[model samples]
Target: MRWSIEVFFKEAKSLLGLGKSQARDFASQIASISITVLQYNVLGTVKRFKSYETIGGLFHEATDGAVQLSVTDRIWGILQELVMIIAEAFQIDDERVMDTLINRSETFKHFINLDKLELKQAA
Candidate 1:
């Protein structure tokens, strides 16, 4: 269940640039996120039907569906993408790195510091 939601957010951010929008005006930024969510929801509903038709009004078509891949399979897919990104960033072979960062004892301090910084900025 968590994986499904994670995948949704990942797709939303990656495909639609939800939080990555660069609109200068506040209203435009809000509208940017709103449009991203709208696109995500519409595609999610359409994906439920296993048909990728681009016809109009199909966004309101029957939703409540599942992907062809299982949740575990989907998670593995995400992990593979992450691995590729990190490997390329680090100049390492894709197979050579089993990268774990936030959970490591040495990196937890940095994670907490970043979380604190984000919270402070948000507040």
Candidate 2:
């Protein structure tokens, strides 16, 4: 029990900066401590659900999962797959199909942010 308390204090200070607030006023310091405790509770809850062995490990894993592809990347992937399917169906070169689509469809270009130069490179 004592060891667990020590671990909590150590991790709370090291990971959450529990006492690092430079606020000179008593109320501000209390608020800062409250925020730190809240952060610790949130992380603890996540750790409980995720079964992470240590606070540091959970912190790193949580941060690593934050990265995601943007809207443009998803749209570009869908467009590439569609172009490939059309090329396969028509027995035409992918580049040729892509050129035709880019040249003729003003709406497609406007929606997808693709140009002939980019289409050439992508194909």
Candidate 3:
């Protein structure tokens, strides 16, 4: 996931023709937001579980069964909006940035689907 995000950032930077420092700054911000969203999703899931067993049981349930699903989705939306804002700030192409964001999001979604499939098979 980290690698995918890094790749997305690099691709976006290259497409935008940003300098190394500016690209690094933008990537850093994106990474920070991603980490925040991940942490929120994890913590939110933990909070939703009444006990360890319930938390463990999450893996056996559907991907969308987690209480943090909606929150994570919202976070992703916010991240995309932020990327658009950054593109505007840098005078880069919004469509290019949006495309990169969408690609990265699709990659993440694929992983989520794979996890759900694995969980279903296990159960």
lDDT of 1 by residue, 8-122 (tens): 6777776557699777999999898889778877676666686665323343342324336779679879978998898999998877664354445566568678889999999
C-alpha TM-scores of all predictions: 0.38, 0.48, 0.28
Candidate 1 collision pairs: none
| Top-lDDT candidate index | 2
Cα error, residue 50 of model 3, in Å, equals 15
Candidate 2 per-residue C-alpha lDDT over 30-83 given as tens digits, one digit per residue, 9 for 90 to 100: 999998888778888888887566788876676687696778888888988999
Candidate order by TM-score, decreasing, is 2, 1, 3
How high is the lDDT of residue 64 in model 2? 81
**Whole-model Cα lDDT per candidate?**
0.71, 0.84, 0.61
Candidate 3 local lDDT, 57-84, one digit each (tens): 4433534565665876899788788988
- Scored by lDDT, model 2 comes in at 0.84
Clashing pairs in model 2, backbone N/Cα/C closer than 3 A: none
Report the C-alpha displacement of residue 14, candidate 3, in angstroms.
Answer: 60
- Which candidate, 1 or 3, has the higher TM-score? 1
